[model samples]
Target: MTALTLQNAIARTEAGRARAAELAVAMNIAIVDAGGHLLHFSRMDDAELGTVDIAIKKARTAALFRRPSAAIGEDSQPGGPLYNIESTNGGLVSFGGGLPITDEGGRTIGAVGVSGGTVPQDVTVAEACLT
Candidate 1:
């Protein structure tokens, strides 16, 4: 399988940034390979400092789990099967905004994460990124 290339990562980041701009929100975007290694990152001019790490962790969470991070969050709620899963994989951001990037064959190739906005906004931008 082809690996996640810099060009692919940059395209996703740019798409995400455009979505954030359209939403009138500054955001930080993180793109990671299938193995959860960061490949490309973007911090919009006014994005919060705290969002940098949060964005990266979100991408890592999605990449590691091969699903949207929010799915993990839902399953990890109190008394759920994956309770406390956020404490694993060096700290995961199990909230909305992280989504696995899958190829046409349905293989998870990477992930995109967006932060520096509300959960819904972040999720929207991430969705646009993968559009």
Candidate 2:
């Protein structure tokens, strides 16, 4: 019902980052609008450099596909219906830590992604942002 503005993205990213800190894991966080355009991003000190791109990809994938990237990852495994789907869309990141951000009207407004930690840790941080 409403656009995902930069202010909203920044607040979400900060919440996610705080959760990551509490978990004692550095993280790279990304937030993107429905169109897969970046709204905000943050890479915590000591976070893995490589996860910067992965975080962005996760956010974009979640926003574009309108689902958790973890679900996509599960479906994209061998013998699954979405097998090899990751190879499409210039490389979709079908992994954990990507989650669609829904508005009060239950419409997807954007997405949040977390990386630089283990899958579970990343998922936890990402989910924390939704609260």
Candidate 3:
């Protein structure tokens, strides 16, 4: 139960889609395994093509770090510890919109990423999927 099943990924994606619909935002969503490998993906009809790679990268960032992508972003600032982190990992996305998906015991099993909206909005949608 720790790792997300295909059904789990789908449900998560659906939840994110529902949340994005509520906000009237079209989004590109991605789900990745604990190893940061992609599992499933969805791009809304109106989602921008530009966000596709961003969504996947966000998912990978969260999965690889076992933390929210924004957290990495925060520490990657000018004088932060992860300043050059974005340059590594094949160009990770440090901004918001990425989150680790944990099990009931609080261990990250996978991650979800969302894009095609403002940072806050992307976070909101990403959180929705994890719920």
Candidate 4:
């Protein structure tokens, strides 16, 4: 199976971080490999320290599940088998603003995460960088 190179992961993560900062998001950004391993991270100076763990959790959840964490939250609705799935992983965040990064061929390669801004603001930053 093909994998996302570490270099690309770092580049994308940094790009996302920069975009967020440029937007005055004051955020923390993180990238995780396909296997949910952290590949890169950047926390803006104005961001809260607590955002660090939230960003990592978002990246890990997206990478490990190969989907956006917001989708995971959707799947975890009441009466759904995935309900409360977040409880299974102490470091997983099933919230919005986390998205999986896919390869050119449309296969999941990794994930990018952002925190410290509003959920939509974080999503906007991530989308801006990826697009």
lDDT of 1 by residue, 1-131 (tens): 56889998898888888889999999999999999998999999988999999999999999999999999999899999999999988999989999999988889999998999999999999999898
Distance from true position, residue 16, model 3, in Å? 0.4
Estimated TM-score per prediction? 0.97, 0.96, 0.96, 0.87
How much lDDT does each candidate structure score?
A: 0.93, 0.91, 0.95, 0.81
Give the alpha carbon lDDT tens digit for every residue of 35-74 in model 2.
9898899999999899999999999999999999999988
Q: What is the C-alpha RMSD of each candidate to the true structure, in Å?
A: 0.8, 0.8, 1.0, 1.8
Considering only N, C-alpha and C atoms within 3 Å, which residue pairs clash in candidate 4?
none
Task: Tell me, by lDDT, which candidate is best.
Answer: 3
Model 2 has an lDDT value of 0.91
Q: Give the TM-score of candidate 4.
A: 0.87
Residue-wise C-alpha lDDT for candidate 3, range 1-131, written one tens digit per residue: 57789999999999999999999999999999999999999999978989999999999999999999999999999999878789998989999999999999988899999999999999999999988
Question: Worst lDDT window (10 residues) for model 1?
Answer: 1-10
What's the CA error at residue 103 for candidate 2, in Å? 0.8
Worst 10 residues of 2 by lDDT: 5-14
Error of 1 at 79 (Å): 1.3
